[model samples]
Target: MRNSRPIILFPLLCFLSSTISILCEPNTLVCNEKEKHALLRFKKALSDPGNRLSSWSVNQDCCRWEAVRCNNVTGRVVELHLGNPYDGFDLEFYRKFKLGGEISPALLELEFLSYLNLSWNDFGGIPIPSFLGSMGSLRYLDLSYAGFGGLVPHQLGNLSTLRHLDLGDNSGLLYVENLGWISHLAFLKYLGMNGVDLHREVHWLESVSMLPSLSELHLSECELDSNMTSSLGTISEVHFTALSKLKVLWISGTSLSFHVNSSIPTSGSGRGFLSGIVDTAPNWFWKFASYIVWIDLSNNQISGDLSQVVLKNTFIDLSSNCFSGRLPRLSPNVRILNIAKFILGTDFPFHVQKMNGRSKLEVLDVGLCGA
Candidate 1:
C-alpha cells in the first residue's frame, strides 16, 4: 500500500487451511482456479531482494505471497508491484538485491492486471515488449530508471484505460516513431518521461501536444540539458492550441555555453532545439504561446528582458543570457524569474520592492548580474 506493491503473503498452511475452508463454496473455488494460472506466471517473473521471494517457493501456492493482489470477485491476479521494498537498505545492497530481467511476455495472459510498478530496479537494457499495450485493463504502468531502450511501442496507444504512465529515466528509449499512437489516449492524465530523448522521435512531441486530456506532463532531461530550453521548440501554435487544460511542463537542458554537452540556442521551428529544454527562439511565434504558465529558459543564450512574457501563471527565466535591460515589470500573477549571468548593461532592480507586491512571485534567482 505504501509504494503500491503487494505485501501480503501468509503462511502456506494458513493459506491451505483458508482455501480448504472456502472450497465448499463453488464460486470461491472457481475463482481460485482461474487465478492460479496468473499467479504461476507471476512466480516465474519475481526477483526479490532480501531472499523474501525465496519463500515464493514453487512447492507452495503463491496466493499467500506478498506483493500480489487478486480480485476478490473474479479471483484473478490484478496487481504485480516491485519497487523499493526496503527503506533502510544502502545503495550498494539495494543494487545487489535489485531485480533485472525481461518483463515476461506471459504478463499478457493475466488479462485482469490493473496496476504495475517495475521501477527503480537494476533491470538494465531489457526493452518492454510491444504486447504490453494490448493489456487494455492496465491503468498504471511505471517503468522508471530501468535502462530499457527501443522506441516506445505504438501499441501503448491501445490502452484507452491508462491513467498514469511513467517511463522516467529510461536512457534505452532513444526514439519515438509513433507519436500518433499516444495522441488517441484521452484517458491518460499523468505522463512522465523524464530524461527520455525525443530527438529520435521529435515528431511525437508535436503529436502528443494534441491530446486534449493531458494535464500533467513531466519530461525532465528527456535529452541531456539541465535547463528546459530544448522543449520550447516543440511547441507550435498549431500543435498546442488544444492544450488549454495543460498545467506543468518541466524539461531539462545545459548551461549557456553548451559546456555541458547540450544545445546553446535552439533555432528553427523544429530543427536545432534540443530535447527537454528549448533555449533559442525561432524567428516567429504565434500569439497562442501566452497559454503556457511557466517558461524556464534558465541555461541558454536567450537574449532580451522578460518584456516578451505575458503568461499569467508563468515564472519566466532569462538566466545565463546576453540580455541587457531593466528587469521587465512582471505581472502580479507571475511566480519565478531567473536572469543570472547576463552580458548586460543594466542591473537587477536594487529596490527589490517591485517583487514584494506580487503574491505569487516566489523565487527570484539573479546571480552574477551586472546591475
Candidate 2:
C-alpha cells in the first residue's frame, strides 16, 4: 500500500509541473484583422505573375506572409518589402519576376508602417502615386529603377521623417520641375536621383543643400550643366557650408564645369568625389582631400597642374582630362591610379620607380600620356 501511494504522488507531481510550464509560457499575438484586410486589398491591386505573395492567403496569419513584417508586440504590419529579388543586369530575369499594376491606397491603413521598398520592379511607366507623400510614418522609401514616369509628386516633401529616398535609374522617365518640396526633408540622409532629368530645376542645389543630414548625394546623368555648377558655386558657398555631414558625392557625366572660388567653405568629412567636370580644383577641396578615399574627375575638360596637389586618396582616376606637367606623387595607400590620356611629363618612369616599393599599388594606367 505504501509503494502504490508513492507511485501515485510521483505521477501527480509530473502532471502539475507540466501544467505550470504551459501556463508560464507567453501568448503569441495574431495579426490585427484590420491591417490584414488592408494588406489583402493592397495585394489585390498588384499583378504578381511570379506568385511571390503565395504565402499571403486568407487562412494563414498575415504576419507570416512573404514581404510583410508585423510588430511582435502590437501585431501591426510595419514593413512591406516588395522589391524585386534579382540583383543582376539580366533584363529577362527582371521581366519575368517584376511586380506590376497600381499600388493600392489601402496601404494608408498601415498606420505604423515605416519601411517600404518597391525598387527594381516594372510599374509600366505610371506616375508615382501622389498619395505616398501622405504616409507620414514612412522612414525608408525606395522606388529606384521601378519604371516610374512623369513628374515626381512634390507632396513627398511631407515625409519629414524620411531618412533614405532613392528614385534613381528610372530610364530617364522621372523628372521634377521644382525641388522646393525637398527642402522639407531635413532628416534625409541619402538622396539618389541618378538618371532622372533635372534640367528644369534651376534651384535644385539650393533645395538639396538644405538637407544638413545628407551623407550621400547621387545626381549622375541628370542633364545638369554649367548653369547648375554656377548655381552650386553660389548656393554651396552659403548653404553647403552647413552640410558638414556630407560624405559621398556623385555628379558624373553631367557636363558640369566647376569653377572653384576662395569663398567656398571647407566643410564635410568627404570620402568620394566623382565630379566629371571641373575647371580648377578648389582650394577647399585640397584642404579636405586628405580625408577623401576616392576621387574621380575623369573624361572632363579639366586642365590643371596636379603636380603641386598631394593626393592621399586610395583610388584616383583623373583620366581623359587636359591635366599637364609632372605626375602627382602617389600616396602609399594608393591602390588604383589612372591618369590616362593626359600629359604627365616624360618622368613617368621615375614616378613608377618611386611607387615600386608601395605594395598596395595594383593598377597603374598612364596610357597615351606621353609617358
Candidate 3:
C-alpha cells in the first residue's frame, strides 16, 4: 500500500510543477498579432517629431507600447491615449511633441478599442477621418484641439455606444452644417463642441435634446445666433423636459438669448451672448435657482431689478450686464460672486455689506459697479 501511494503522488507532483512553470513564464503574454500590426500601421501614418512613439516597434510587444492599453486576459488593444502631454498654452512644447500626418484607417482594425484620444495634436487642418465613424466599439472619443478643419463628419453618429464625445476648440475651424445625425447617439452622456461653428445648425437644440442620457453640454464660442434661441423657444416643452439628466450647460460667447423654464434641469449653467436681450429676469427663472450650483449671465444685455432674486449657487457671475437697482441676496453657501460693471445704484446693497460675516464669500468682484 505504501509503495502504491508513493507512485501515484509522484505523478501528481510533476503535474503541479508543470502547471506552475507555465503560469510563471515571463513575457508569455503578447498582444494579438493582427492588432499589433494594425497599431504599427497606424503609427507609420503619423509624424512623431519628438519620438514620443519611439517604443513602438515590431520587436517589442505592442501591449507594452506607450499610450496603448490591452486586456489582461485577452491581450486585445482597448484604448489608445495618444493625446499631447503638453498643455495647450505651451505652444513651444506642443510644436515639439505634437503628432501630425493623416490618421490612418488602420485604427478600424482594433475592433476591441473602446477609448481613443487624439486631442491637443496638430493634424495640419485636415478633415477628421470619416472612417472613424465605423469603429463601433468606441465608447469615448476626443479629437479636441487636434487641428481638424472643415465639416464634422456626420458619420460619427454611428457610434451608438459613445458616452463621451469632445470635438471642441479647433480655433473655430470645425463646423457642422447639420446635427440631425447627433440624435443617433442614444447613449451619449457628454457632448462638447466648444469653438466649433454651429451658426448654421439651426436645429441644433432639437438634435441635442434627443439625447436622453446627456449630462454635460458645452457649446461655448459656437457662433450660435438668436435664430437658434428662437428655434429653442419653439421646441416643445416636452423636449426640454426630457433632459432631466443634464447637469452642466455652457453656451457662452455666442449671440444666444437666455430663457429659463421649469423644464431645464442643471447644476452648473452659464449663458453668455453678444446680443442677449432680456428686459427683466423671468420670475420662473428663480424657481430652479436653488438647484443650480453655478450661474453666469455675464456680458449680456440683461436689465432688471434683481433685488427680489435670491441666488443659492456657489458661483454667480452677472458681470458686464445692464442689471439695475439693488443687488440680489446671496445665500449662505455662495462662495464666488462677481457683478462687475453693473448699474446697481451708488449705495451698496445690504447683502454686500453683510457678506463679510454671514456668507462663505471668498472672491467678490464688484469692480466698475455704480457703487
Best by lDDT: 3
Clashing pairs in 3: none
Which residues of candidate 2, in runs, are more than 4 Å off? Answer: 1-27, 227-236, 260-278, 294-299, 315-317, 327-330, 338-359, 365-371
Largest TM-score belongs to which candidate? Answer: 3
Query: Compared to the true structure, candidate 2 yields what TM-score?
Result: 0.79
lDDT by residue (tens digit), candidate 3, 253-345: 554455542222232233324443544556555545444576566664556677777777787778876666667777788888888877553
Q: Give model 3's TM-score versus the native structure.
A: 0.83
RMSD for all candidates, in order, please. 11.0, 6.9, 5.5
Expressed as tens digits, the lDDT of each residue in 224-272 for candidate 1 is: 3333334434444566567667666554342322222334444433423
Each model's lDDT comes to 0.60, 0.77, 0.79
Q: Per-residue lDDT of 86-192 in model 2, one digit per residue for the tens? A: 74387777777889999999999998999999999988899999999999999999999898999999999999999999999998899999999999999999899
Give the lDDT ranking, best first: 3, 2, 1
Deviating ranges (above 4 Å) for candidate 1: 1-31, 52-64, 85-90, 224-235, 254-297, 308-363, 368-371
